[model samples]
Target: MRLTAEQIASFHEDGFLVLQDWFTPDEVDLLRTETYHEFGNDQPGRILEKNGAVRTVFAAHKSNDVFSRLTRLQKMAEPAAQLLGDEVYVHQFKINAKLGLDGDQWEWHQDYLYWLKEDAMPTPNVLSAVVFLNTVDDFNGPLLLIPGSQKMGTIDLDVEKKYQQLDVAESWKPTLTADLKYKISKRTLIRALENSRIVAAKGTPGFVVFFHGNTLHASAGNLSPVDRLSVFISYNTVANALQPIANPRPTFISERDFTPIAALPDDALLAPRNGHSSPQREQLASLAG
Candidate 1:
């Protein structure tokens, strides 16, 4: 799972690295099955697209074994650690299901922007590892990444008034606040980066992409008949965890844990689910009984 020096260099230069077939077809089948299982449940942290399709199911690691292990996958975790030069932890995990036509556009933004402003992250030592769970093509709203955008570092955005996601007290402070909510992409910066190439990555299931935290990226609304399913595991260096900040998003959006992740074996994700139940599975069985 170690990236070659050249590959690492490429990631630093271009702000992203795409690995084709990082997961086998079999592995993707299992994970995709679990993804759909999550989509079936209606719960908090499962956010909806503006058109009402599920945008993301956050924190699946807490409730699913397959996803839990994925957060610590060596292939994924090692890259983050190597780039950040420190041990890392999961900052956030999400299953993004962009259903056809109903899928909404994700405004252009950088991951570290949210981490720095909302979580008080001190450095851009965080990165996102995305596993495409279904076929992704240009028409299906593939992620658009601005090449070398991370080199410019964090951008100061003109943030709008924080929209309340909950009905609770506006003045009362929570761990997460409205002011730190995600802002729309700044148009001036977009115009500035217009010269940079925008890479629209299209790949089949199991392809993985690792991107810098400050990479400017976004996706168009899914207008085709196909769904674009993907999973994102954000890794933050332990040394660069977070300082105390104002009201933050819920735990699902920005996890509070700072424990360093211990990478599981390369074969850890290959275990068959049918032969033996995972700890979470056992719990589920007991609950059903």
Candidate 2:
């Protein structure tokens, strides 16, 4: 779990690192079974599937034994602690299953961008660890990352609008002006020393990938017949500031009561609102019970 100097440098420089076979086959099977069991039984407010499986937020300590065990593993927590400097909390943890059929592709956006709201100060106290629960190949649409994009800090809102437009248009073929803007924006964030490569990381079920919160990443639609499953644990240093934004009707736990975990200096990120109650909250209340 102790990252070598080279591994640490690669993550800092390129915004991500891939550790092969970080989980054993048994661990992967246990986690996968528990996740599927939890999702299938409709355990209160557990799984949310619009196009694919998205679990709501659960306190790290309060999660099921399988999940809690995964977090306790040194191989998983050590690198996370290294990045966040020892004292950290699991701000979020959930199972994300992309069924290899016709799920919606995610927009290319920074994880912390939603936090940049009206008047909030940012904190540098977050990182994410994604443990592949199944072997991920191009057929199942593995993750794609923009190397060193985290150093770009938060992307400009104006520029993000352009990316969104292109994404929605499903236009890999851009106009001259659009292509120029894309190149300029992409160039500014990527590191000169590193090459931008789409990660077709095919590893054992237990392999783990770590990335900075601001890293620009996207996934292609799942077209294969099987499901591509991943368990994500998001860690945040205790010193990180948190605020809550109001949610009138929330489908996910993150949208309802979860607080923002990390931010950059001078940026305003929205946090979850405190003291909220709704049907969704009531459903999730059983986790505490």
Best by TM-score: 1
- As a whole number from 0 to 100, the lDDT of residue 213 in candidate 1 is 96
The Cα local distance difference test for each model comes to 0.79, 0.58
Model 2: per-residue Cα lDDT over 187-289, one tens digit each: 4434422656545556768788898878877677678987888877777655664555343212222222233222111100111124466654443334323
> CA shift at 145, candidate 1, in angstroms?
0.5
Measured with C-alpha atoms, the lDDT of residue 168 in candidate 2 is: 34
User: For candidate 1, which ten residues in a row score worst on lDDT?
Assistant: 171-180
Tens-place lDDT digits, model 1, residues 40-105:
889887876555678778899988989987877778888878877799998999998888887777
Collision count of model 2: 12
Candidate 1: misplaced stretches above 4 Å?
Answer: 162-187, 190-195, 273-289
